[model samples]
Each structure stands twice: as structure tokens, then as C-alpha cells.
Target: MTTTNAAEATTATAAARATGASAATDVLIVGAGPTGLTLACTLARAGAAVRIIDKSREFHRASRGKGLNQRSREFFHDLGVEAEAAASGIEHITLRKYRDGVAIADTVTFADRTPTPGMPYASGLIMPQWRTEEILRDKLAEYGVAPEPGCELAGFTQSADGVVATLADGRRIEAAYLVGCDGGHSPVRKALGVGFEGSTDAEECMVVGDVRVDGLDPAYWHQWFDEDAAVLLCPFRGSAHWQLQGIPERDADGRPAAPTLESFQRLVDRCSRDAGIRLSDPTWFSIYRINVRMADRFRVGRVFLAGDAAHVHSIAGGLGMNTGIQDAFNLGWKLAHVVLGRAAPGLLDTYEEERLPVAAWTLNLTDERLRAVVEGVKEAGVGTEAVITDDVTTLGVGYGWSSLAWGGAKAGGRAPDAPCRNGRLFDVFAGPHFTLLGFGRGSAAALAEAGEKCAGLLRTHLIEDGDDPGGHARRAYGVEGDGLVLVRPDNHIALSAGADRGAEVVDRLLRLGR
Candidate 1:
């Protein structure tokens, strides 16, 4: 508040930087949401120093972006928070639809499928966005890194060597890289002068809030559909609050009403058409308009954009938050590699090349799903179920067109999880190391060569018939004989080739780091 205090703080920061105890980090994360937290956990797991900061002084208790797709669950598993997230979230949530206040249809939000040896997380989880962030934050704390609250990125400048970021408090932090995980109206993206081109539907708006309700069953996600309006009340896992979403009546100015408790209560009363059901104790609320947009570039020099800073999707398929989380997952390893000098800086270019198309596809997919929901509501009083296709799970997403993908179609796709005598293929692929699976006894020589040559950079496993008694690993990889599959740190297949070409594939894997 005074000049003396500001001078003392600056002096203290300088002394700390000189003593290597300052805000300077290997990576400076400019947001503390799920995306930023996921990135922090990822880089920290690899022993890269990270400092995550958020502008907000207090953590949010709102129920925003309240679901995780199957692919996201896999990342959570990789981050070592699967058990905690599972304990706090529910999977296979059922949607109970109603017409004119009478129950009409009951459907599960996910496609009915059995978990196989190759795909253990076949279903998505229903958890509040706040809890997801909490889980990630808790995991990040294990690395002795916690988000700095009330610290905001005022601006930043990057040279060829590193980035110097200035905070709102007149503190300067130097880091090898800076990431923008701030949401839709990202200051980082805006400061970079990057173009965010997309469309926003002003007419299509939903009132979302967390509230305590009476006389409603907490088992199913209750949806009430009318001729022109709809409402959905979903009970959050491990919390007394139910996330309420409703299409509210617009005003003469063609804008939805404010997201106040009274307005939400009115919406529930009108759309639900239930006299017994009542809303009370509203904690958080917001009016969400459909905004589908993507930044022109994910990277500008050493500064990078990720998560909502790079892309924003409609909430139709519940992909907005998950996409951001995955964006962090995709960029985390690349940033760590470059910062740790394990890879060339050029490897960072693949981030945009691989993720831009995915964001474009996501925007298009959510738009279609939103349209389908609108049409389904008009035709059959249904919408949520229309968005539950397998495509929304993001398991089918890949980077086959990426420059890093070698070999055939299997390369660049997510490496399937398979049962092994020890544990699972994922266990072998875990951590911040490349994985080389040499299938069959014939490839043992190649595995040994890779293990000796690559050492700490790669982990080689010779998966023989005895190691996979059930033959799931071979079947999952489509390898009938000796073959080699190289998996990247992000669990994407880098190369899949026959045993005879294993030596060549190993050489190619070695070149990726350089």
C-alpha cells in the first residue's frame, strides 16, 4: 500500500532470485484451473520446476464444467489421482428425462459398453469442475508446488534464452517458458495479439448454478423438457449442492436474464412445472452463452497458450474443460523436454500442429451436438442423450498427421492399455520416459539394445507370450509375431513395426529427443 513496502518487496524478490529461492521457475503457469494444475503436476512429475499463479484471491466453489470424458480419466490415472477422483466423482450417471412434469425416458449418459483388458476406463466420470481442480491441486501439492493466489500476470517478454514475466504486484519472474492457462478471455492470448476467431450464439444461453433443492431424487440427473424451455438438475458427487441448468426466457433486448438465485428459482418453477420442487441456498451461478472459438496460434516464441486460452467449446458434449485438460497434457511433456534439454526446441512446434486440428474438430463436434440437441428437443423432447455418442469420449482422438508420428496408422494414436503379468501396459508406459515394447522373444535383442543405448531416456520391455498369458497385449497391438511399439511419454504410439525393423525404429525414437 505504500512506497516503502513496495521497495522492500522488490528488494526481497531480487535477493531471493540471487539466492535461487525466488518466483523464478522452469515454467511459469499463469492460471490455476484444471488446465494449469494438470500442467503443473505433469512438469513437476518430471522434476521440472514450475510456479502456478492465479489472479483470484479465493478458490471457486462453483460447479462449472462438471464431467470428465474417458480420455481425461486416463490422464488423471497417469497423474496418480485416479483413486481420489474416483472417490469424489461418480461414473455412468443416468439421465432421467421428463415431459410436462411426467417422467418419460431414463438413459445412461455414456454408451453401454463393457471395460475390456485394453480399455479399463470405458466410461466418463461425473464430477464438479471445482473438485477436479481440487484433486489436481492436491496432487500438485505432493510435488511441493502450490498455486500462488492473488498473483496475476500483468505482462511478459520473452527472448531466445528465457521469459521474464511481470506480475501485478511489481514482481518479475524469470522462467524458461511461460504458459497461459487462463480461461476464455485470456490476458495472455490477448497480450500476444493472437487472433481468436469463432462464433458466439447470443440467443442460445443457459442459466447454470449450484443450489440446494428439496423434493428431488439425488440418484438420477433430472431433466424437464417443455415445448420451448428445458431444465436439468444434477446432483454433484460428495456434495449437497445440485448443479441446476435451465434455458431461461430472454428479455426484449435479446439477452438472457441475470443468473441470480431468484431468477434461477423462477426458471426452475416455470420449466420444471413442479409445485413440490423448490430451490434454496444458492452458492454460485452464471449465465453461459455458447462461444466456440480457437486461437490462431498456440505458441508465440517461448510463450505458449493452452486450455481455454487456446480454445473454448460449447458445453453440449461436456468437452470444454476436458479439452483444456488434454491440451495441458499434450503440451506439458513437450515443454518439460525442451526446458530440461531432453529435446530440441523445435519439438515444441508439434504442440500447435497436433492440437490445433483437435481444437477445430472439437469446436465443430460441439456445434453439431448442440444443434442436434436443439433439434432433438423440438422433435422428441430429448437433447442430452443425443450428445452421448462415443465420439465425445475423446478416446478416438489422435495425432496421426503429426510430424512426430512414424510408421503407419497406429502411430500417433493412443496406445491401448493391456493386461501384463506384472500389472498393465500402462504401468510400463507410466512416468516421464519413452516406452519401447518389443513383442515376442525374437525382439529381445532389440529390447536389450534399446535399454542399453537409451538408458534413462527410454524403458524397454520384452513382452513375450509368457508375459501376456491372455494374449491381450499382442491382440491389442495387432502383432502376431515379433514386433516393436515405441510409445511417447504422453502414451501415444510413436512407432509400430516388425521385429526386423526394430533397430531402425529404435534409432528413429532416439532422434526425437534431439
Candidate 2:
């Protein structure tokens, strides 16, 4: 909650210099949302000097992004905030269909699945976006880096070596790299002249907000659908409120109407047909026009973009915030490597090379899913969770096509979580270093040599065939025999190979890091 006013910012700048804080920080992150906060925490954890700022004067209060997909859950686990997130959230809720205020069929969004030894978080969680941000900000505070509120990025110019950023309050700061985690109307992207090419759906719009309602059961996500309009109320976990989404009739100009409490009440009355469900004590509201867009490029010189600044899409799959979280996670470690001098600048290019396509794919996938849901509602009088597909979990996301991927079938994919020794594979890969999972006795010598060669930059773990009685690690990683899987700081496999070539794969990967 540090305030960055004109005088305070100037005094702080002077104090930083007096205390021998670098004239140029390693990273300057704009926007204190999930993407920027996640990146700040990652870089700070990796011992990089980072400064994160937000245009707003206070932390956001709205539960704008609520769903945390399975991939994000795993990523948060690595960041050491999974338990808090899970505790503060609900795992899943059934969507109960209602017509004219009468309940009908109930559909569960996520199928029931038990946690396997390899996959700990088999399903997504539902928590308010404000809670998620709170968790991330708390973790960032632990690193002694609180986001500077009321500090806006006015303008910035970058050179071959560093970035010089000017704040709106007339303070200037220098940084080795700059990142924009700002929203879709990103000033940074506009300043960089990057093309955010896509279309905004003018025909369809949603009124979304959080409100307290009476006479509605809180156990299920209640939905009321008629021919032309629909209303959905999903109870927010750990709160007395529910998130409300509805489609209202357009104005005379055939435009999506603005959101207001009165309008919301009217829509509810129309959809519920006098069901007696009353919405009150509104806290937040917004009229969202679906925008499917992606930045043509993710980086320009020493400056880069992540989150909504880089891409935006429909909320059908609840991928907006989750994708942003993943973007920050992917960029965090690579930026740390370059900042800490453990990797070449070329490593940074892989950020866009790996993530840009994912964003593009998400845009199309969500667009189609949104269309499908709309069509289903029009055809069947109810929309199912069929749009919440396997891809929504994001576990299948990979970088197999990237140049960094090498060796075996699992290369460039997420390193699966599995039982190892007394703990798990993720426990071994929890830190800021690369991990080499050596399986079976034949790989012992190669693992030892690779570990010695990579020393501080890599951690090698030998998972003997009998380490876990169920052989979950081997099965999870698809290691049928003696093998080695080299995992990057981001927990994606960089190299996977047979025991004989484990050391060679490690050497080659390290050379790329150099």
C-alpha cells in the first residue's frame, strides 16, 4: 500500500540512489494486475531488482476474473501460493438451469476426477479475482517489493542497453527491461505502435457484476433463460455475493446497452418472470463487449508486453486472466535468466516465440466457444459446460515447435508433477534453477556429470525405479526406460533423452543459456 505521490516519489528516488540501489533496476513492470504482480514476484524471487507500478491509486476490488484453471493452479503451486488460493476458493459448482424461475436440469462444469500421483490439481478453482490479486500481492510483499500505487507510466524510451521511463508525476526511472501488463487499452502497446489486430463483437455484449441476492439457492450456479435473453448468477466463494451475467435487449440504435443496477433488475425480472429473486447492494458492474485481439509482437527492444496488453479475447472459457497468469509465468523465468546473466539475450526472444501462438490459439478457441454457447442457448433453451474443454485447463499447452525444445517426445511440454523420493517432482523443481530428472541406474553417471557441469544453474534428481512404489514418476514423464528430462526454470521440459545422451543434452541446453 505504498503511495507514490510527486514529492514522495522524488524523495524515494533520491533515497534509492543514496542507498546504492541501482540507477537502473533490472525490470520495471507497469500494471499491478495479476500478470504484472506474478512477473514481479517471480523476478524478485530470482534475486532480480524489480519495481512494479499501477496507474490506479488502490488495489482493484472487483472480482473481474474468477476462474483459476488447472494449469494456473499448478503454476501457483510452484509459486508457493496454491494452498492459500485453494483454501480461499471453491473447486467447482454445478450449473442449475431454470426456465421461468423453475429449476430444471443441473450440469456440472468440470467432470469429477481424483488426483493422480502425477497430477495434483485435477480441476480448476473458483475464487474472486480480487482474492487472487491479494494472494499475489501478499507474496510480492514478502520479497520486500510492494507495488507503487498512483504511479503511472507516462512515457518511455528504450535504447540498446536499457529503458528510461518517465512517470506522470515528472519522475524518471531507468530499467534494464520494461514490461506492460496493462489492460487491453494498453498505452504501452499503443506507444510501441504494435498492432493489436482483431475485431470487437458489436452485436453481443454482457452485463457482468457482483451483487447480493435473496431467494436464490447458493449451492448451484443458477441460470434463467428465455428466447432472447439469459441471466446467470454464480455464488462467489467465501462471500455473500454472487457474480451476475446477463444479456439484455439492445437499445433503439441496436447497440449493447450500458450496465446499471436498474437495468440489471429489469433484466432479472424479465428473465425470472417474477420469480421473487431480488438483487441488491451492488458492488461492481461492467458492460463488456467481446474483443478478440492479439498483439502482433510481444517485445520491442528491451521492452515487452504480457497479459491483456498483449492479447485479449472472449471470456467464454474464462481464459482471460488465466492466460495472463501463464504469460507472466512463462516470461518471468526467461527474463530472470537474462537479467541474472545466466542466459543470453536470445533467450528472451523465446518468450514471444512460445507464448504468441498460445495467445492466438486462445483467441480463436474462446471465440468459437463463445459462439457455441450462444448457439446452444438459442437452440436448446440452455447452455451446457461443453465449452469448458480439456484445453481450458491449459495443461496441454506446449512449446514443442520452439527452437529450445530438444531430445524426446516430451520435450517442450510441461514437466508433469509426480511422486519423487519422499516428496514430488514439483518439490525438486520448486526453485529458480533448471531441473534434470534422471531415471534408473544407467543414468546415474550422466546425471552426476551434468549436475556438476551445470552446478548453480541446474538441480539434478535421481529417481530410482523403486523410489516410488507405484512408479508414478516414470509413468507421468513417459519414461519407459532409463532417461533424463531437463526442465527449465519455468517447469517446461527443455531436453528429454535416453540415459546414454543425458549429459550431452544438458551440455547443449546450457550452451544455449550461455
Candidate 3:
């Protein structure tokens, strides 16, 4: 940890008020990984002061989770960070399932949606975790914030008024809310005495990293499900670089019997004898111990947990970071509202109710993915809906149970995207403002009514450009005509309606966040 100063002393004072310790911060985030960083950026963009601390002194160079789902892309786009990530060697892949080197099943591809919103990233993206972090860091910098590195959360105490955290140096920083975006083994979780009761899987999956190999292929994320051993390989930037993992019977070379280039190579040779391809080189390797577990609760008074601190799951779907990022996304604004006194404390509680169920659902599905591979379902025999729900980036994931959820429209089930007169493809759910979608002139007066009451508190958009937009926005979100929609600050559809229904839709929206 670094030396503390007077500025550090006051950082936690903005989060309402705290008991015991008086340090205040609007949001005190523990952990500067993707989730924590995303939370910081989201809140800061909305003008909330934030402080994020990470135990790591610097960005981790090793690559993890080589695939980024579609839902994540939408969130990143809203943050205005996805553009750089999309350009930074992120490959657009046609997801495929292969068993013993034979293509068996293909995932729901993003190809059918012509000219999707958040284009270039309309589908899944293949980019390394480090690169993703780089983009996030850059975005954070734009907000005049930097992550506090090498400073760990030593201990903390929370109360209804606020959370007071005791630093390793014995200083107290207070914030109205404290979030543990920490990992599965969170210090904050330990301090809170939260119960993480889920059990671990029997399997031990090993992974190896960042090794440059001449013989590896660059086009796809490949998996080999041998009844005895399974291999997962992801290519890096069309280069010889790859991340490989294997389940080993023993720790040869004294390395953890997890994934490594060596083990992957050996497994590749074995699978080749069965399926006929050769793998070479000795690079990075490590083993993963799978645990599909989640905390019994996400919030306890002023203290909250997000990301892996809330749930831990298999690496099967590469969902760990994405899930946490979404966790941060869900909670960031509610905390801001609570702090700014724009909404009631009850709104913050919805964060747990909404995100916890999604986490549990994701953990279960990912666990099944691991089971499918381990049980030798063979990528060919795999019928898993890796992303059946669509909006893999998690942007489409909704909060069906919210006080602000005024009513349901025909597009109630999925995430909505639309063409706008503003020459932009608007995702009805990207946070940072109160969004008003205008289908026609009839809804304009009603929208103005809602906007006038909110003052500088709401941002309104009218979705009235009748042009086809070449079916770009229509196919991406399946909305073909002008329709009014209201998006909340947390990126969820508040209300949707056609021209005739605009007044009714605006009336229901005016009823929200009051």
C-alpha cells in the first residue's frame, strides 16, 4: 500500500454519512479489475465522484477470457469505450462447435442482423482481457479518474448511514455505500461475514497463458472434449499467441496440473491421433479449480457486493468478468441516485434483487457448459445455448421486477434498439440519462411534460426518423416503425409504445422515479 494523504483522508466523505469512521466518499469501490473500473467509469460519467482501489500495483499482462459476449459490447458502447476495443485486434468470429475436430453445431450467429447497433461489435468479440482493461483504463482517464493501485482493502465496518473502511495504515475513509467488486475471496465479504455457500465442482481445469507458439491456429476459439481430457484453445490476434487449458491426471514438470501449453500440446497430440491435428510449443499454462458458487446475499445495509464477490462460476463461458461488469453496471446508478437524493434508498435494494437472480442463472448455465464438456458431449453433440437469450454482452439482460417498470409493450421480452432522426442507433437501455423515445409528433408534448418536471435531471430522445435505416436498427432490435420508448439510467426499457399509445406511455413514464 502507498502512503496516505489529506486528500485520501476525505475521499470517502461523499457517500452520505458513516458510523464509527467518518470518512466519506460517494462510492468506495474495492478492486480495480474490470468490474470495479466499469462501476467507477459509469458513476463518474454521470458526475458521481468515485474512488477505486486494487491490490495489484499494475495491469495484469496475462490474458483471460478471450471472448467478449454481445451484451458487454452494448454496455461498453454506452460508455463510449467500445470503439477502441472493437479496433484493437478484436476478431469477429462465427461461433462453432466442434467434436474431435469435426464441426457439429454453430451458435446463434450475429450475421442475420444486418447493420446492427453498436456495429463492428454487433456480434461477439475476440480480444484479450488485458486489452479490454486498457480500453477501460483509457475511458476512466477521460473522466479524470485513475485507479488507486497497490492499495488493498484491509478491513471495514458498515452501517445504515454509511460504510467506514479501515485502511492497512489505520486510516478511516467513509462512504455512503461500499461495494466489494473484489473477487470470490473478497476481504470485504470476509469482514461482512457474508455466506458464500455454493459447492465446488469435482473437476479441476488447468489453464496456461500468453505463450507464443508457431503451430497454433488463429481463426477460432476451439475446444476438444475427450471423455478423459478436454482442451480449450483461443487464438490471439491472428498471431501465434494463444491461451490453452487442460485437465491433467498429474502435475508433470511440477506445474499445477491445470492448463499449460505443454499439457495442451500433449492433449492436442492425443486428440490428433483421434481427430488428426498436431499442436506444438511450450508457453504459458495454469490450472483452474471450478466453483459455481454465489453469496447468499448481495447487499447488507450500506455494504454491497458486485462481480465475483457476489458469484463465482466456471470459466466455461468466459463469463466471470462480463458478469461482474454487468453487476457494476446495474448498481452504479442506483447508488448515485441514493447519494444524490434523486431516488429513495429502496431503489438501491433493487440492485440485489435484479442482479442476484441473473448471477445465479448464469452460474447454473455455465456449470452446465463445464458438465457438457467433461461428460464428453463432444462439441458436435453440444446443444448448449451459449447465448440463446441473445444480447450476450448482457445489455439485453433486464430487470423485470423494478418499481420504475411502469408497463409492458410488444417488445417487452428482449433488449430494444432503434433508428433515430439523430443519425444514431439508440439502444433503449443504455444508462446515463432518462431517455425518451419519440415515435411521432403526438408523443412530443407528453415527453416534454416528463422532461419539464425532471429539469436537468433527465435527457430525452425522440425516435421519429421514419426512414428504413436500411433495416439496420429494425433487424438488430426487431422494431420496424416509429415507437416511443423510455430508457432508464441503468439501461433497461422503462416503457415502449406506438404513435397512438405515446401519451399513455409518457404518462406511465412520468409515474417512474418519482
Model 1, 391-425: lDDT tens per residue? 89999899999998988559999999998867988
The backbone clash count of each candidate, in order, is 0, 0, 34
Q: Which ten residues in a row have the lowest lDDT in candidate 1?
A: 1-10
lDDT by residue (41-91, candidate 2, tens digit) is 899999888999998998877889988999999889989999999998877
- 10 residues in a row with least lDDT, candidate 3: 1-10
- Runs in model 2 deviating more than 4 A are 1-21
Worst 10 residues of 2 by lDDT: 1-10
lDDT of each: 0.84, 0.84, 0.66
**Cα error of candidate 2 at position 259, Å:** 1.8
Model 2 scores what on Cα lDDT? 0.84
TM-score of 2: 0.94
- lDDT of model number 1: 0.84
Model 3 bad stretches (over 4 Å): 1-24, 94-121, 238-240, 249-265, 273-285, 375-396, 410-415, 427-431, 465-484, 497-514
By TM-score, the better pick of 1 and 3 is 1
